[model samples]
Target: MIKPVKGFSRLSKKEKIEWLAGTYLKDQPDDVETLKQYWNEDTRLQQLHDEFTENTLSNFYLPFGLAPNFRINDRLFAVPMTIEESSVIAAASKAAKFWLDRGGFKATVINTVKKGQVHFTYKGDKKKLQNYFDKIKPVLLESVKPITANMEKRGGGVLSIDLRDKTDELENYYQLHCRFDTKDSMGANFINSCLEKFADVFEAEAQRYEEFTAEEANLEIIMSILSNYVPECLVRAEVSCPVSELSEDTEMSGEEFAEKFLQAIKIAEIEPYRAVTHNKGIMNGIDAVVLATGNDFRAVEAGIHAYASKDGKYSSLTHASIENGEFKFWLEIPLALGTVGGLTSLHPLVKLALDILQKPSAIELMKIVAVAGLAQNFAAVRSLITTGIQQGHMKMHLMNILNQHKATKEEKAKIVDFFQHNTVTHSSVVEQLEKMRKG
Candidate 1:
């Protein structure tokens, strides 16, 4: 029988990931050739190569487990996240437990709507093109009726359609914006379909020379693409944890703890090097989920990094504190992902992960991922403040170092002891371990 996570005291460092993943895949097929084949499907190998060559890979896999005790918006969920940094899963789990003692994370999503742009360049006179959309707004909306019917039946659909005149020095183009509900998916394909459906109408309306005569408006449909994904829609989560839960022996004050915590983070905010790693920790959580769900990590990565340096230079990705002596954390990042079709369906294991989630739509998954990111950020900042960052992390590293050379348990223990006692001299430690094994 699967055991319930009690707390930090009961956790075993060696089996952390296996425990956290729970019924999730334990031993992913270790056959390198087979694994390489799996990874190569859908040009993933090329992308990974590009990423690796860019020197952007920071091996961020740690066995940090966030214990369950959360109920978000009256629903129970077991959130599993993979990240390599100490304290993130622990801190988030701690904060979540505090909230569980009260109510849970009260959250709501605005709408799962996204915008796609269709750019049309024409000599139909920029002013005339503008008037065309203005005149056909009702017709376009009417045409969207059939497209949106299914979404409407499911309680979502087209909220509005907009057009704007963007004139380049060389030529003029009209951008048509279609805002529609993606239902439970990312809605990219659906949005693209809607735009294609309007192609005939758009061409007829912007008709230039029929067979090379009468009119002279050279209409060209350059690109029908999605917008930059402005998050006009949102999923907001507010968890009110009782202050009583976080206190220790002398009845530690949550407000005071939070204030001190904020002060430490303020230091990271002021320093660039610290900010880079600090922000990387936040992405640790976000990217892990993006990877696990087979979602586009690149889009989320671009959006977040861009958001961090929005004012110019990059900075932290989360804001956390205590309100009324209760911990409160908020994180915002551009999360453009789909739970339906495409990669989500293409991979077999991906489907299994989603099945474990038992979530109905992409929005629910996004909320869970957002929570993980906040949890991870909290874990990172808290560790930096309370203990020196290297302490917990180095201990884990010791295991990896000892695992090198296929060291036996006793050899591993000896090496760790020597390292901890400051007697480690790389060549000496390895020679000693080998000598002991030979004897």
Candidate 2:
């Protein structure tokens, strides 16, 4: 067992990962050996270690940190984030703190159910299908009942089912949409499992006609389906900061800054380049927190990106403005995360992070994550409006660079000071550290 730090009663997952990774880097052991030492399952960790060593190891090691002092819907908490991009942590923390200086933040999330789509292609007679609605619809919907019993027990089940036809795009093809209430789980696996039953139901109903051959009729079911970003069953967060706290650091009036921020929002709506990076800033904090908590970051990323272009045009995910002379921020994302399954159960460090959170349900986890997304967005927009993103991130990057060079703490400070003064170069950092070492 590893020893705990003196002051840290509850280290977040990012912290735990850092502690283990830093130890591994210091010891510089074989990858497999490193995996075996900290991770529970040697076999599983070894595979991950190999994959990480060969590919995307650089992507994996981005500096992960936590934004502290967040009060979401009157609950005090900290948000775990992993990012290499500069100023995100500082910006998020400052935005959160700004709200706290008022009455603290009040963030509320809906029931947190995610919709799973089941797509299929049927190039049968769309004209004849107009005469076949009742028979096919009831049977198809009924077939999913048994599969949804467990979900019903947990107070969630099949909420609704929808169907659409697209003959203009693809000839003689239609789409079947299955909208299920996943309860507290991401429900991708569960939803796909029920698709076969639904397909069987449809096939049996259609087989009544001699011409309706599922095989010969060219029928295919596309599982791992897509989700629509509907306003109903949406996750929304509203953060308000009081004008009193705006005076703490006043190069410009809070009202003046708010107007400038509002103008930037209008600009981002029209500019694709700014919107892309702007949304990325929101994800930087969000993806880290999700990954740290053992949620599927890929699905979340896909959903958010898809939601960005919902208007048939690209736009920023976040909207900020100075409302009534106080900063008001709003964000919406379909974060389909589950608290009690998969990696949360298998991973050692994930369990440790959950224990620190001490939330009772999956909905609670969603609330925190949504709030983190908002905090991250707030931090980013504030940075862009103020001193730019680089000034804050460069310091942290220097610390990492210093650590990589094995510079002593004093040497790190000296080199970092030199770095702040001018552009930092690896050779220059090494030479400076060497001179500091000798001196």
The estimated TM-scores of all candidates read 0.70, 0.79
Q: Residues 1-439, candidate 1, lDDT per residue (tens digit)?
A: 6556666344443244344444443455343233334343455644543344232212233342434665777776666555554445555676566566567666666545567877876665555666666776777667767777776787666677788667664476667777876766666666777777665566665554233223434466787877545465455555445555544422346555566667766765677787788878777766766666767777677766766787677776666566665666666665666788766776555666677677448788877777666656766665666655665556555555556678878778777776675534446556877787788
How much is 189 displaced in model 2, in angstroms?
1.0
The CA lDDT at 32 in model 1 is 28
lDDT of 1 at 123: 60
Candidate 2, residues 255-274: lDDT per residue as tens digits? Answer: 66677677777777888898
Listed per model in order, the count of residue pairs whose N, CA or C atoms clash below 3 Å is: 3, 2
| Candidate with best TM-score | 2
| TM-score, structure 1 vs. true | 0.70
Give stretches of model 2 more than 4 Å off. Answer: 1-65, 82-87, 110-113, 209-233, 416-439
Error of model 2, residue 25, in angstroms: 20
